[model samples]
Target: MQLCEKYVMQLLGMSFLQYSKTPMNDRWRDKDVTVFTMHDLVHDLARAILADPVNNKGSVVGNGCLYAFLTDCSKPLQLSATSSANIKALHFLDSGKLELRGDAFSLGTCLRVLDLSECLIRKLPESVGQLKLLRFIRAPRIRDQMIPNCITELSELNYLNLRGSHNLSALPESIGGMKGLMHLDLSGCHGIRELPK
Candidate 1:
């Protein structure tokens, strides 16, 4: 029994080590690879984890492993695929000229936190309302941008930071409908003259 337990632990450790080395291997050997995206990395990680028999033993363990990998990774990337239903947070900092596809919002129905700080993206899709689970949004420097009125429909939103958005003139009148809002930062938004009633 002791030998069996030791073997099982070794197997688990090897599985984790194999996954942890994947991105590094790609970075070192695939210098010429240009088609790889964050979405591809995530998809590859999922496939690698699921292919392990230890993770596939139960849904609870599989999900736990996936979340652990995502949270513990030194650099987390933004969502870019329709298959990213389990992603909870997306951070797109300084990623140049991000042009979000129309169906992107619909794909991120499970997102809890979204940080697009300093990204070149000018506007958010009206389908932002579909992210009912979103709790935090930090989008700074999106000058002259007008957020969709549908944003007020995010009943779970708690923190919204729009600092340095100088040309953002106004908030939607329906802003009051976001009952869960606790913190709203509009610092550096010089165009706003009044708040909506």
Candidate 2:
């Protein structure tokens, strides 16, 4: 079965877009690339539901502390330190390459999941390693960046996607020591000569 199908993530019957370039094909086979997306209305409703009044983070009940947010911020990106303490997720999939090398990691102490698709974050702060609860990270296309060795300290992290991050010459030496890491995607990373031993 397909990955989405296996995960039961087929949203609205059209929740995913596959990469298909073959011509003259009527039938759709299980392809390699699968990108998840939803209709604009679905996105709108999600934003509305996740909108927090005071913290400007995301929550199902608006006032509750399910704090997560979708951002499309520009340069000099930052978040409120006090408010980010309880935040759980932060998605920058829509935002362009953000240079989040500042207060974001230090403040977002409770971040469980973080998506930084194509972000310009060449390196992360040491504070990110301190977030013990971090479980997933989707940081594709951080080309030539040096992911901090501190990242391996996240013992709770289970999933990490770094596809298309070309020119990343090395991974943390202790990457294999991350016992909790169940998945690691390094597709299109052409710079690495070999996996860590």
Candidate 3:
């Protein structure tokens, strides 16, 4: 796995990219070295929590390397490699809020599930649509950068939980366009009144 920092519009200094050298569906057994602030350790821990396939008690659980952490704040790089080169889940638990320190559109091309819970995210970048395989999003406070109508383009999405956004007012009409979605949780979106109709 390789990680890089790159400049992205709207974000000044906190963006990263993840890349892989092989095809997905393979196994990523080699772990890459990453540096984290003591304060940022939780972010990596969060990824480990989500990426772990078995319970610590020794129960075989979910499988997949969907969780990841950001090493650079400028460009995206390979976070890890398994037999599977594609990202299936992501656990971004950085204490810092979600401010694009770099290009918001730099998410890796093969990412799937994304977990940004408990982070400080106010808006999603217009480039979010680039995750063609993204099936899950856990941010509940993304209120800015409208959920691009382009999100409807993601035919693979299944779960969407926006349960604590107090300021969000409405869902993108395009949301109805996500035909593959199986579940949607908007329990905390206080201002939202109706689904896209």
Candidate 4:
């Protein structure tokens, strides 16, 4: 255990030694770790690290980390101007309780993938059309909401996932404008009755 701590400290320049508890029982003995909690922690940590301006300046696509997860809906997902400029992918997982701010989409001009699966977001800002580089989107299936026609403006979009979006009754006729699209997943989107010609 000491060896593991030492290795981690050497690698991460920090130590979890102080966080170690119940050394006699291997410290994890009484821990109540769950998959959800662990995922939340990982998401929080990724967001914190990516929020730093230092991580935003480089030309690294997606800041060399293509994924950012915001698991907690109680707090708004706020991205610094620079951080958003460099981010490539973002996920708002199962946040059915929170609404995403409109300005959030305007920041990630270079974003390629956006996952809003099961989120409570009611509308996407017109700025969503400004993300010309975006390639994938996972729109939520909230009944009262509809996907804006501006989504068709993503000419570079390759994948669209509307799985389980039960409330999505229609897609814009302009969807055919996405010439680059290759994969469309409408599984579980029972409300959709027809595809645009």
Q: What is the lDDT of residue 115 in candidate 3?
A: 57
Judge candidate 2 at residue 154 and give its lDDT.
94
Best candidate (score: TM-score)? 2
Question: How many angstroms is residue 133 displaced in model 2 relative to the true structure, after the best TM-score fit?
Answer: 1.0
Q: Any idea what lDDT model 2 has?
A: 0.62
List the lowest-lDDT window of 10 residues for candidate 1: 66-75
Ranked by TM-score, the better of candidates 1 and 2 is 2
- lDDT at residue 184 of model 3 (Cα atoms): 83
lDDT of 3 at 46: 45
- Against the reference, the lDDT scores of all candidates come to 0.60, 0.62, 0.55, 0.62
**1-197 per-residue lDDT for model 2 (tens digits):** 78857554433222223332445333534565444445343353356445646443533343254444445433322443235666666655445655655455556666766666635666555667777878767777764556879889999887787877786888999999999887798998888778898
Q: Which model, 3 or 4, shows the larger lDDT? A: 4
- The C-alpha TM-scores of every prediction are 0.58, 0.62, 0.56, 0.59
Each prediction's Cα RMSD?
Answer: 15.0, 9.6, 15.2, 11.4
- Candidate scoring better on TM-score of 2 and 3: 2
Clashing residue pairs found in predicted model 1: none
